[model samples]
Target chain A: MKKIISVLLAAAMAFALAACGGAQSSAPASSAPAASSAAPGQSSSVAAYATSLDDIKVKGELVIGLDDTFAPMGFRDENGDLVGFDIDLATAVCEVLGVKPVFQPIDWDAKELELSTGKIDCIWNGMSITPEREQSMSLSNAYLNNKIIIMTNKGVTIASKDDLANYNLGTQADSSALEVVKGDPIYDSIKDKLTEYKTYDQVIMDMQAGRIDAMIVDEVLGQYKNTQLGNVFEVAPVDFGEDLYAIGLRKSDTELTDAINAAMKTCIDSGTAAEISTKWFGSDIMVK
Target chain B: MNLSYIATLMPALMQGLAQTLKLFALTLIFSLPLGLVFTLGSISRVPPLRWVSRIYIWIFRGTPLMLQLFFIYYGLPFMGLTFDRFPAAVLTFVLNYAAYFAEIYRAGIQSIDRGQHEAAKTLGFTPWQTMRYIIIPQTVSRVIPPVCNETITLVKDTALVTAIGVGELLKAAQGAVNRDVNITAYAVAALIYLAITFVMTMAYERLERYFSRHQKKEG
Candidate 1:
């Protein structure tokens, strides 16, 4: 009886191993159909986009990717529900396109890969338009005017960019704000004292603790965080030039890009965009 | 593959390595002694002490260390306790590792022969003296292999602190990759890790040999 039980245990282990192997081998087989189905579209240069407007419509959902920690744009509220300016705008855009809006929170750093892999139909977050991004992704026309600004704890004072040389600064890594800071001529003097955090939230925390004297951040995000946190931060007047925020889609998704641009223009022109903007920012800051 | 590019990355990667080594060293220093205390507590005659030790081991061992780091660094601020990044990372590492090391120590202690305890008792050795002279010395040798395994794991696990933006070796490699859009920095980081583990393996082998020197030689 003991021998029989041992044999049965061995067989069970073998069966489990075989089952895992079968599942592993079948994963690629499952994706094979989707690739084969896209072969015809692949041959036609016109339908070369991994996903198209018609495809998204047929699917009945537009998966909009964003970093949910970014406030006033696409972030979670106190109740853990996603609510922000971009959240409202994307929903409106999806409404115009006649598809359900699906917000997929993604690692902000991996947003490009998310778009390329078709994990997200588009990045509709307050993504700043940059040359590097322009080369990689098909971007909609500028929808929001943004600027990188210096923010400090309420008592901390900084008058100009040159004054930044004296303070220990923080900025989010892989961010456009960091890019602007690094590009600035003053960066060389203060570069040694700069800390790159994973998110603006951490930067704000460090600022509150007096670990970092100031944070270089997007105007929209900095204002939102400052207001949300009971105005514990003071915005420095030092500007890092204008940065335009736009929607990012896969490079091949030209038709979808056009569709989104048109939809965005309609949102701006119809006063619906202004109403949404007013609801979030207390003013209609939507691009005319 | 570009030599100049690799050279440019070396400084940042070395800085990251320095941070990783600091974390590994500090964790080992604090966790090893604390682990011994925990092992003793878990085996104590007192129910409350044993239960506390057991529950700590259960919680730390069962949950992911990443969550602990997040809780200590991020979540704690909500309840009025806050720690800076490096301290929080080190504190979390020390706590998490002590639980693991405690289990290893317990296993090592329990594996000692019953005859040794009996002999020690017969020789007028008190419980404390028996543990100090006979049990612990033997347990050290028995535990070295598992302890070495855990030490190597600790070296790799230092990368998880990057979740809290501590910027250790792996995060530095990722930063380099992001900056240059090349993967060569990762290869460099991998080699650095390999060098560390290789040295650790050699050291542990020597330790094993040193510990087993008194064992009867095989013909």
Candidate 2:
């Protein structure tokens, strides 16, 4: 009887601990800034530029939103904490601006709400700058140039974009590739024939097992997956469209835009961006 | 905040609610029998059959449902199997919950007395007949509460299916939160879940009363 009671108690304790562990796992974002600041010269003089970017500088922090599952760009680590290339970039940008960075994991499709209501001061993921998106948000200069490539099973015979015409292409719904396929003139004939999924991971699985002909995804991601999948998949260099990675700021905050552009330039000159890109992507894919 | 936004979204949410209901309804229809088959296999006199059923139960019950969901939706296609989002979500849920329900059914069936089986045998009934007419009726009564509890859990567990992108209630709520950045939308979503759960609880109570009605009469 005592043994049975103890076994039940152990099971109950294990369950309680699991529940607590799951609940405490928050998205790993940079911690909020201290209520005070270090003395002058301890860090770069952010005060000189404070009057220019006063709205966010006065707030003493920038809330940056991203979908943390995108790798070589942004993703959660084993600890369930958000960490990746975009995370490193955001940290560096915040350090230069002398503001704290708070990370919020926003669904990719809902970035508009994450920005407009000030839940995040900016969108700093591998956000592609497009003509339509320019109408809604202010953007910095193109920080990196990327194009969508065809990731396919090695034995499948896709060599170029035209070779993929009749085949069903898999891409995440609402992603740049999906958008281009739906709206752009290039893919019009084949748009209706495509299968868009919620996650490209699902599509990649299909491609691996020959369920689909190819997956349309960013070139960098395609490279990462090719390396991970070993020789099972082949990446076609032929691309559907040029996707430029840029920082998205609210249209109302031109000062923040100018500030971020300056930081981008500094990071480029200092080789910080290239170093971070190498750390994650294993090569410097940074735009000059 | 506007009536029009609510008006537009209410229809969409309702459409999603229908899918949620379909997934919920079909999972019960399929898994209930599947659970019984599993129960029988697990309790069978044959060692290999019993062992296979035990391992199936152990694996499904031991892993995180989210990991199981991802493995099915993402990992399965690598092995050359592809299921549509709705079917994939439903299949995973049924397979997962069936394993859990099997254990509950087995416990209830095993709880019946050895004398009951012998009594049925003395009355010239075959072994299968004894199990069908004698063992199953009582087991049904014993397992109803646990089965209902699982169904309620299934309703919530269905939300994890969003990883495969079925656009169920919680995903809709996420869409709302992504656009607004307020907790009110999340709160409203929680209320929707609460409403579903409450209705199920009441229905389960009615079922328990209906089944135990015979016991009350005998008393």
TM-score of each: 0.52, 0.52
- Model 2 per-residue lDDT tens digits across residues A16-119: 65564334321111000110111222112112222237777788888787775576577644333557788998888788888888876655654653454344
Report iRMS values in order. 16.5, 17.6
DockQ of 2: 0.02
Fnat scores for every prediction = 0.00, 0.00
Q: Name every residue pair that clashes in candidate 1.
A: none
lDDT of 1 by residue, A1-288 (tens): 976875576456556655654454333233223221222222132223368889998999999987665667875433336688999999998899999999876656546544544557889889887766776678999988778888987777798888888889999877789877777788899899899887676687688778999999998888877775678788887789987899988878888999999998888888889999999888877778
The candidate 2 chain B region of ten consecutive residues with least summed lDDT is B175-184
Residue-level lDDT tens digits of model 1 in B1-219: 878868888887887899999999999999999999899998887755776677678668876897677556544543456576689899999999999999999999999989998999999999889989989988987899999999999999999886554768886676554333346778999999999999999999999989877663642
Regions of model 1 farther than 4 Å from truth: A1-49, B1-219
